[model samples]
Target: MSWHSDDGSGTTADRTVEVWPDDDRLAEELGDALRDAELAERVAAAGRAALAAHRREAAERDDLALELFLLTLVHDSELAGGPVGVRDRSGSTSRTLVFEGDGVGVEVELQDGQVEGQLVPAQAGRVTVRRPDGDVAVVDTDEVGWFHLDARPHGPVRLVCESTRGTCVTEWLSW
Candidate 1:
């Protein structure tokens, strides 16, 4: 199910709740499985991944924003369908990617081996930039929702944001 929320910013945001299939057997099996601590941990991780995938799909379709956790894909980029970032004498390139998830949005710019950006609606939060290998950097956004990270390594990357506005994860993008 889905509901609306206001974070004292006077803006209403939509949130989605967990939903389970209408199958007693499956529920019973999951209940039994949870009894095993190790198994339960694995199951939880798998479930989170699955939920992320679902959110990514919904975000790609321009679905409503989720208050608890929002996973979104890149919505637009002037540099879309372009070649690798070109570094000039300054040894940095500039490309802005915009991602939208309901009431929240993140705009990231990569340049000079650093990732800098701002969050729409401007709230304090944390930004984690991760690659398949692991998280490359985690930084806190100022009260105005601006964050910066240096020493970025190029590869496939995804961004996760957490704040009073809630959590949001962006789809994997080449960096």
Candidate 2:
């Protein structure tokens, strides 16, 4: 269904479209609907671009967010933010992912060997990580823009984020 929400500026003209059931059939219908709605194609394209940009920004920001949160936990909680080295039912070890943000940090610990890290909203996406062995792993962020990479067993590994905006990388540390 097509919906709209105001920007809370006391003006209904300044509205944001909210589409539901983002499925293939819905998408096709939306594309057809856009043909009838005035400037709907531009609106949809702009909205998609904006959402893609936001996803890229989140991925770029995640390394810092993870680092800062991990630092806080390591100092305040006295917990090891490293790979626990034990495999779960999926045959992958759990890892605590700490990323730093501006004045605020986020920590996500998952028992899945790698954090599903970033959600890029672009079909054309890349996640480059410098492996502990000095090899690089470049992966597509998927259609929905989600990407995952296994953190190294030990030694210094760096996660590099690259997208239409630019590129950013994390610091080297033995995990």
Question: Number of the top candidate by lDDT?
Answer: 1
Error of 1 at 73 (Å): 3.8
Overall local distance difference test of candidate 2? 0.55
How far residue 24's Cα lies from its native spot in candidate 1, in Å, is 40
TM-scores for every candidate against the unseen true structure: 0.53, 0.37
Q: Cα lDDT of model 1 overall? A: 0.81
Clashing pairs in 1: none
Task: Give lDDT: candidate 2, residue 92.
Answer: 61
Scored by TM-score, the top model is 1
Compute the lDDT of residue 38 as modeled in candidate 2. Answer: 66
Q: Give the per-residue Cα lDDT of candidate 1 at 93.
A: 63
Q: Compared with the true structure, what per-residue lDDT tens digits does model 1 show for residues 1-175?
A: 9999999999999999966667887788788888989998998999999999999998866643534455575644445676666565877667678888878888887776788899887989999998998888899999999999995677788888888867788888887
lDDT at 163 for candidate 1? Answer: 87
